[model samples]
Target: MSSRFVFSIMTLLMTLISTSSAQAITLRGEIQPDRYTYYLTDQYAQKLWAMNRDRNRTIRFNLPPGELVAQTDVSFAYQHPAPTAITCISSIYYNQGARANWLKVACIDNNGLEYSTHQKWPDTSIAKRVCKVGEASCDAFLTMSSDNWSGPQ
Candidate 1:
C-alpha cells in the first residue's frame, strides 16, 4: 500500500478509538447506620451520582436484569464490620416496569455481606420512584428480624 493511504488509515483508526472512549467518571457518597438501615429514599440518585460523578467514591457497581430504576429517598442499613477489601462492578439491564423492558441499574456492595433492595416507578430511566423493601428479592417487606438478643418484635 502507498504511504499516504497507510497514514490516512492509521489516523482514522486513532480518531475512531479516541472518540469511542469517553472521559472516565467518578462517584462518591456517604451511608450512615441510621439512614442505611432501610434503603435510603434517595438511594437511586445517590448510587447513580456515585457511579457517574464524584471521582474518588467507593462502591462502584452495576445493576442486574429485571430491576427497574426509580428515584426515592428511603433508608436501609447494612450488616457488617465491613470487608477489608471490596470490588465494584457496573452493568446495565432491563427493568420491566409494569409497562415494558426498561433500562435500570443495580449497585452491589460486596463488602463481606449482602445488602440488596429495590424500588419501582412509572418510568425506569427517569428519576422519581416509590421505594419498596425486598420486593425485588420476592422476600417479605423490611421488618426487624425476629432473632434478636435485645428483645422480640
Candidate 2:
C-alpha cells in the first residue's frame, strides 16, 4: 500500500476508536459474558437512561415489564458493572445503604450482559444531566415499555 494510503487508514482507525470510546461508561463495564449480574445504583441507572434517550431521540426503550417496586438495593459500583437499560424506570426513588444507593424500580434484570440495541453504552455525563432535571430522580416523567429497543416512533 502507498504511504499516503497507509496514513489515511491509520487516521480513520484512530477516529473510530475514539468515537467508540466516548460513549463508554466512565466506570468499567463489560458488554458480553456467558453469565453476569449487575448491581446498579439509582444515580447510575438514571444517567444511563438519560444517555439512551438522548442517543435515541425518536426511539423509546421498553421499561422493565411489570409494576414498580417500593424499594430496591443499589450497589456502590464505582466501576459500573454493565451497560444497563432499566427494565422498569417508571419512577425512581433513592434507596440509601452502606453498600449502595438503589431505585424503586422493580423491573426485569439486565446488566449489559446480553446484547441489545445500545451496544455502545453512553458515558456518565449524559446520565448526570438527566438526574439534574429532577434533583433527586430522573425517571419522574420518563417512561419505557417492554416492547424492546425501538427506532423512531
Candidate 3:
C-alpha cells in the first residue's frame, strides 16, 4: 500500500480515537501476505496503525467501560488477528445508537471469495461464529488459546 494511504488510515484512526472517551478503540495492522507477519508502522498515543496487504479495509474494536485496549484480557480476545497466508483481513466498527459497539469484519479468502459479519463486541455466548473470510483456514475469529490453526469451523 502507498504511504499516503497508510497515512490517511492513521489520521482517521487518530481522529476517532481522540474523540471517543465513552469507549476504548482498538485497531489492528494489516498482514504482509508475503511475510505472514503484521505490517506495523506509525504510532500515536502508543497505538500502532497499519493497513492490510490488499489495502482495502481497516478494523476497530470497542470494549466495555473501564476496559482498555492495552489490557491482555481485552485485546487478546478482540484485537485484529495476526497475519496468515490463508487470507487477508480488514474490519470496521460502528456507533450509531443501539448499534454502538458493533463490529463488522470483512475478509477475502485465498480463493478471493468475500465474506463478512457484524457482531456485538465481547460475545459471551457458547455460539461461536462458523464461516470463512480472507483466510482459507476458517479460524479468523480471535479465539483465546487458539494458535494459527486455520480450519473451517
What are the lDDT figures for the candidates, one per model? 0.32, 0.34, 0.34
Question: On residues 1-153, what C-alpha lDDT tens digit does candidate 3 reach at each position?
Answer: 999999999999999988653332243343212211122122321231122222333344553431112212222223344222222233444557766554443333232222333442212121123233344444443322335668877
Better of 1 and 3 by lDDT: 3
RMSD of each: 18.8, 17.0, 18.1
- Residues 1-110, model 1: lDDT tens digits: 99999999999999988865332222222221111112323544355434333344344245443333222111111222222211122223334455433322223222
Is 1 or 2 the stronger prediction by TM-score? 1
Flag the better candidate by TM-score, 1 or 3.
1
What TM-score goes with each of the models? Answer: 0.23, 0.22, 0.23
The most accurate candidate by TM-score is: 1
- Model 2 poorest 10 in a row by lDDT: 27-36
lDDT per residue for candidate 2 within 9-103, as digits (tens), equals 99999999777523222212321211112335666656444443342233334444321221212322222443443322222323244243322
Runs with alpha carbons beyond 4 Å of true place in candidate 2 = 24-78, 81-153
Candidate 2 TM-score over all chains jointly: 0.22
